[model samples]
Target: MKARVTISLKNGVLDPQGKAIAHALHGLGFDNVGEVRQGKVIELDLGDIAAADAPAEVEKMCTQLLANTVIENYEFELLD
Candidate 1:
């Protein structure tokens, strides 16, 4: 099965990297873009894992190491 974990900053949290990206975009003439929030996608090829178990397993990995739960939130989805 294939899976994906998306990690993002919680609401009201300041994101300097996101700001930088927005700035760069505006400089490149993308002036209509609004606030840009940044996040990350982690793809996994969980070979041989059951479809029912992949989401939970990837979520555990997110809680343990992939994300900082204090200021970040994560969600996982099974792709196949």
Candidate 2:
């Protein structure tokens, strides 16, 4: 099984990197883009431990080590 985790800043949070990218895009003549937010994606191969509780376990992992819940929000998808 494969798990994909995505971590992103909350809506009200400021994202400097994303803003920079947006500005660069606008400079390159890409219009109609309102805002951009940067985030991270982590892919994990949990070989053989693909159970119904996997999503919760992964969420726990994010809360415990992968993400700073105080500023970022995390979500995950499990694939077989």
Best by TM-score: 2
Off by over 4 Å in 2: none
TM-score of each: 0.90, 0.93
Full-model lDDT, candidate 1: 0.90
Worst lDDT 10-window in candidate 1? 50-59
Q: Candidate 1 versus the native: TM-score?
A: 0.90
User: All candidates: CA RMSD in angstroms?
Assistant: 1.1, 0.9
lDDT of 2 by residue, 1-80 (tens): 88999999988899999999999999999998879999999998878885887888898899999899888999999989
| Whole-model Cα lDDT of every candidate shown, in order | 0.90, 0.91
Which clashing pairs does model 1 show? Answer: none
